[model samples]
Target: MISGDVDAELRRLADDPSFPHRDAARHAIRFRAEGDVSDLVAIEDDPHPCAMTDVVFAMAGSKRTWLNWVPMPAEAICNVANEVGSRRAEGEDLGLVSLALSAAEPASAITASERVMGRVELGIGDFPAPDIRMPLRRGRYAIWRYDGTDPVPAVPAPSGAAIRVLHEVGGEPWSSPLSGYVQAEPLGALPLADLLGLLAHLPGPPDTPRWEYLAKSTPTYWYRLLQPWVCLGILRHAADEPWATSTRREVLLDLALGIEDWTADAALFALVTAAYRESELRAEVHQVVRARLNAAASAPRLVTIEESLAHLMLITPGCTADDRALATAVLARAAEAGEEDEDEQAPPPSKAEKRRWWQRRG
Candidate 1:
């Protein structure tokens, strides 16, 4: 339950005219710090909208944390029209995994999540797979009620299905189901070698039915949403070791250049982070940096590309002069984009432009 003081503080922040993203993020962190159902309901009810990164960071910041939101039977059919619209306006998609990973007490939360998932029947046909992820971290898992609304067009619900209408603060309505969450079994942490072995089984051959299904189910791209988390885990495990020892240099390189922007960003983060601790990885980091700079030359203002470039420059010292030159050109173009952004009326707090979520983990 939300403490009297916490409820009042959230209310005060919501009423303040100058609530910023940082404030919203700090408040969002309360989800992990205090795992009370009423507290989450209060945070959800708060008028100040939160950015997707704020929520992600809160959920993934620690291994022991988890969050499972089980709506009251009376609240199960909630019209999340505003919630849906706000997320779309901010270019975000929420899943059960994202919300449930914020619980402070993972053991109870996991049990609670499993019980809730068992009661909610899975939707049939192309009802869009719920954002299901297993073992977000050691002992932690998440299970939220509503999946994203972006797949509404591509994955229509069967007729007569009980669909929930979602909306942003002021955005149009979109239909989404109130029950798509599924139970995910928790796994123990594996050694680097074992983790690599498990990862090798993913994104299997192109002709398979599973691959075809994934292509149709995922939003916009076929990239695995878990790619970043997995990459980050690998980086954390091998930061102090030589790249050759892990036998996964090629894996990181492939992920760094993957089609999914977030996955690529995570791969680059892993590469650069490792390069800082292991001099042996510097050469590969430089090669990736150069490739990214060249690819970003024409469209320098792209947020993800610029973010990768900035992270490399910040962490990897003594960058090659050629890379520096290319980076300079990209920043020059990005500056022009910033000017345009300044002139446009500011977007909503949740929609405001900012760095990628992984970079802000620090």
Candidate 2:
């Protein structure tokens, strides 16, 4: 039978008495929609979310949406920039990674981003050194959260603090331990599940998937990753386990951020980014930067990092306000040390040389 016959049969089975028939029909429509996402996208403006969700799963789970969305629109619009009719207006979730990355406008768009988001924006730059970096450092998305019943005492204001405390809560029983670090003012604690529930609906890939996209640039990179399967003769395992677990993937990303190597370290630093709240792995992070800078070829970059490292270190959580103040002092001392070196290197003016030079100037 032709495609029309199959389509008709599927519609009939959608409400069929057979248990397997209805389920089969459901999967069939999804697979078919995934292959022709434009058909679904055309109706995205429809208010029927139940009908829309099926399309979302198909597009996210299959190649049809990701592989074909661009060409379909370009042919219709002549230029996607000049025309506004495409799915760009729909705001319907398609779960396409490239769409999200491109929607964020990746590079030039990030300069306008304010803190937390700002640091992450820097990570997308072409190359790091010699590029003018912004002075407005990013902030963490995670605000300081605390639990306690009694009111907590105020902590001293941060002198040269890196982490900008956006909001805070205290006065519950658990406030004592949390109060010392943050320059925390008081508020009521948000319910734990409510807080996480709010976060779960936010767009953007979980950390690992985003990193994987960045680390491997294109289809060729993905194919190369598959070479291990070809060599191992374990095609079944490779097919079954493509993505890393959430925990492992997040750790890899933190490791990537903490360490200064990898091909695009400069690029990563250029993006405005927000990590999980109160997260800092600075010692491990700086060590990676230090090691990279010490490499024979990267001397100038090292010098630049040495100049900037203290400031960057404080911005991550786990660093104290005292640590931040100390870093500021150390930078000042480094400047003084340079002046002393200049004085020490200069030759003492001999009496005869000083007189001759003065006379010539007059």
Strongest candidate by TM-score: 1
- 1-362: candidate 2 lDDT, tens digit per residue: 02235455556766677633354355546546543322333222223434334333233222221111111111101122112112332333322211111111111112111111212211121233422121112222211111221111122222211111111111111111111112122111222222222211111212344324422222112211111111111111122333243222232233223322111122112110111111243344344333332331332322223333443333322334454555556467546755664666456643222211211010
lDDT of each: 0.34, 0.26
Worst 10 residues of 1 by lDDT: 176-185
| Candidate No. with top lDDT | 1
- Alpha-carbon RMSD, candidate 2: 26.9
Off by over 4 Å in 1: 1-188, 191-229, 236-242, 299-304, 345-362
What is the lDDT, from 0 to 100, of the residue 274 in candidate 2?
16
